[model samples]
Target: MSSEHERGDKKGQFCSIPAKPKCGDCPHPKDYIEVCKPTGWFDHTFKRFVNAKDPFTFEKKFEAHHLVCVAPVTQILLSNDGINSVIEQTKWCINNKDNMIAMPLWGHTVKWYCEVEESISVDEVADVINDAMKAPKFKNIPQHDYDHNCKEGYTWEVEVEVEKLADKVKEQGHKLKGKALEGKLNKLSSDFRSRLLDDRGTRKGGTHAAWKLAQKEPPDPDWCQPFSMASDSKVSSKGFPVRVFNGQVAKWVNRIAKAISSGV
Candidate 1:
């Protein structure tokens, strides 16, 4: 998960220059150096994991090596600075590319992967872009700090909620194991995942209650980019702030839940 950065912090700053240089728009020398691609596109992603002992069976769609937890598919930003500074400012981001993704009972192993499904530009996915040409030169705006370390104990809160349900089942003299336990746990966890991953609540015209007018808009861009972080001090001579998106660090919260319930 990502952490929130307090405003005005130097660590939350990002270069103000747009990804692409506009002819008359940018006041800098027309030949200014561009380290990042203005309209870069990704064509593939990679994923790797070890087999799990007691995987999940409820969501067949999410099954992997008998484990319920799996890495989410996302794009990576490869920078020279050893993976920090780039997206750490954003909230809800993973802090490290390679780390143990812990659940309530156990930690699952995962490898970094990158796959870009659509051809989108940097301007398309960036949260905000400076195109007005009125912003200051050599400016560093504060980015939302998303370097929260949620890899471990991410499901603690959710596990507590499920524990209550398990106790109720126990009070009824029912065995909270096998399919019966799996069914109940599945509904709760599935719903929780949906709420966490859903974006409809944040849309402009939610539910399409009323029609809105707008000019011919380009294809809706894929803005879901996952970021990882590095230390604060200058780590590389290259001076790049952002690093490539390592594989997603997904938590298998369900398998652990079952383990805890059955005392495994």
Candidate 2:
């Protein structure tokens, strides 16, 4: 029988442990897996938060040593199954509503939090570490108000558009009364402002030039007639009627308006 099979038989399970490399110098997967297990387990532990699970219970029950115990299991899961599965499983844990709300046994919840905190995309833990490393004095110092200078003119125009759009949309039987509507308008305005800024700065002349260069002959649809509305003039395309007034564009406009008003 193969050594690997023999080892598996001894362990009493068909586990996928890698063979240790010869020459006493090569790094074994087992060692690396062991080392990384804690991080993976921690990731799993925190995943509970996303599903509305009470993480505090698990946190209280498991001391630091327990974290160490689950690390290898986490590593094994991650290596065998893949990260996406890990993420999905954790999500399932969080979404399990049938369990006791006070003290859930959902392993998935803990896993999800750990993944979010330590995972490549969210990296909450890394962000915390980075924030901690930053000089505390820097927090007190005011940030450079570059947006005030660069976006002041654009912001005013956008705000006018937002107010106009809000009025227009309200007239069209869309409810712009609630906080949610206001928030949507604000976001729409901000998005419009950002698009305008980007268009004006980077892609304005270049986009035209590129289009001109790409054409084999004269354009099929004449470029002289404006193809689309400018950022401030465009109505939101969001499906929600209320959101049309207070989406990304409106938010940006509001910010600009606030900045301008504060300055004055």
Top candidate when judged by TM-score against the true structure: 1
lDDT of each: 0.23, 0.27
Number of clashing pairs, model 1? 28
Give the local distance difference test score of model 2.
0.27
lDDT of 1 by residue, 1-264 (tens): 111121111122211112224223323332222321122111111122224596543211111110111121011111213222332222211111111111110111111110111233434422222221122110111111111223322233343444465455546555444355435545554554332223211233321110010100321221111111111221112112112222111122233223323432
State the weakest 10-residue window (summed lDDT) of model 1: 207-216
lDDT at residue 6 of model 2 (Cα atoms): 22
Provide TM-scores for the models.
Answer: 0.25, 0.19
**What TM-score would candidate 2 get against the native?**
0.19
Q: Which candidate achieves the best lDDT against the true structure?
A: 2
Give the per-residue lDDT digits (tens) of candidate 2, residues 82-199.
2223222221110011210111121332232233333333333334323432221111111112121233333334445444544544454544333444344345534543443344
